[model samples]
Target: MFKRLILVLLFLALVFGGIGYWKYRQFQQMTAQLTAPRPPATIASVEAKRESWQPTLRSVGSLVAANGIAVTNEVAGIVQEITFESGQRVEEGAVLLRFEDSVERATLESLRADRQLAQAQYKRAAELIPKQAVSKSEFDIAKATFDAAQARVAEQEAVIRKKTVRAPFSGLLGIRQVDTGEFLQVGTPIVELQALNPLYVDYALPERNFRELAVGQEVQLRMDAYPGEAFSGRVSAIDARVDEGTRSISVRATVPNPDGRLRPGMFAEVQTLLPQRDDVVSVPRTAISYNTYGDFAYVIAKGENDALTVQRRQVTTGRVREGWVEIMKGLDAGETVVRAGLVKLRDGQPVTIDNSVELKDAEVGKQ
Candidate 1:
């Protein structure tokens, strides 16, 4: 019985040993495959090039009419007529509203009649004085009466004119605030008037850029109301003082609105074009990798065995124009950068350039 048990144990041990050896051989093969060097990753590359770059200062702004105001009545009166319709464009001195001026008109007429009588008396007195029929003191008294009557007439005429409200300038009118027969007091708002053409845009810029900003600098604007469209203008005025709280300077630009598509109070994105620079180097925006640490890109460098290797480079980026970005520093002209396949890249990793797709600065700008 003991000999039979020994034979069973030997068989079991041999069977287990064979299974372990097979597992060890499989592990060796897998490790060898995992340790082998991988082929170079295929990537698209673009050469950094020098281009004419126009540096821009971006800001948020609001559109304002060059001339805008709330039309108001200067005197209190019952509104007899509203000559302007809501949203109507009117010219300067155009009668917008008329009050009940009948009483004032009658008063003016009566004063004029008295002045006419006084004028005739003054003339007869002058003639009589020359003929020695009237005393000099009587002539002086007649002249004073005539002057007083004329002054009263002039005052009545002014009161009559005040009853009529005229537009101060050519502009578009808002909805009427007062209707016909509605009474309005002095300084009561009638309507809002805005000059749409040549609209003004008010924006602010950091005080650091104050030296670069000046009147007549070109500006590009975009508004959410008008998507996919761009408006342009030139700087018209700069504030004399910087804002103490924000350390920014106020700037105003005038944009032509011949079509009148732009309206006041619209929010706008403003880009103030600075002077053109010829020394700026630019690259395709796709080549840059943005992270919380900073911006970086992978530059292609020569490697051994005629192979191309990627070296991670830190870059300082500036304004982005279209699909390209201005490389402010850490990159030189003529250096090749990986435009795509950035995720698989590592420092000093080998790469194969597939020039099948070439990215040019002009082409990126068109995007």
Candidate 2:
């Protein structure tokens, strides 16, 4: 019986061993499949070339109207008529609002009638005094009364004019603040008026760039509201004082907005062209990969059998213009760089260049 038990045990061990060996063999085959060399990755690439690069300084800015204000009432009165509609274009001296002026007009008329009577009395007194038909004291008193009456009439007319509100300048009007028959107090807000033809952009730059900044420097502006559209302008003004807290200088540029598409208080991305740099190596912006450690780009290297391989190369980048970036270091003028398909790229990976489409240097400046 013991001999039979030993035989059964040996048979069980042999079966289990075979199953384990089969499993081990399967794992080795799987590992070999995973470790095998992958096929060459197809990618688009561009040759790094030395070209004249226009250095640019980028900053954030805001759009403002060339002339903007909140229209307000100078004198208090009940609004009898709203002469202008909301969002209407208005010219300087255009009547915008009219107040109740009936009482003031009546007062003016009464004062004018009194003044007419006083003038006649003064004329008669002057003639009589010259002929000794009236006393000098009586002539003097009549003249003073005539002058006072004229002054009162002028005052009444001035009061009547104050009841009407006119546009101070030509601009687009905002929403009306007060309705007809609504009484408004002095200095009450009426509407917003803004000159929208030439908009102003206010931006700040680092103090180190003060030397490069100046009036009349060319500026390109991009607003989120208008995608893929670039508005051009020149630097209009530079603030005299530098911000102490941020150590940046404030700048203002004037941009033409003939169609009134740009609005005040809109955020903008500002790019101020500094000066052109000659003989600088540049490549397509897509060739660069940024990470926390640093920036890098994949360079295509030629190998045996005319095979292509990508070598990971670290690069120091500088000013970016249009869709291209300046390579300040770690690259040469004639090296080919992978422009697309960087996500799947690895160091020393084999690559197949499908250079059917390549970026030209001329396209950089067009941006």
Predicted candidate 2 versus true structure: per-residue lDDT over 1-367, tens digit per residue: 9999999999999999999999999999999999998779878888999998778889999999989999888778999999999999999999999999988898898999999999999999998997999999999999999999999998888888889999989999999999999999999999999999899999999999999997999999998898999999999999999999999999999999999999999999999988778989999887888667588888999888878999988899987778888999999999999987665678888998786745444422211
TM-score of candidate 2 against the unseen true structure? 0.70
lDDT (0 to 1) per candidate: 0.90, 0.90
What residue runs in model 2 are displaced by over 4 Å at the alpha carbon? 1-46, 121-147, 284-316, 335-367
Q: Each model's TM-score?
A: 0.79, 0.70
**Segments of candidate 1 deviating more than 4 angstroms:** 1-42, 124-140, 290-294, 353-367
Residue range 111-148, candidate 1, lDDT tens digits:
99999999999999999997989999999999999999
Instruction: Give residue 82's error in model 2 in angstroms.
Output: 1.6
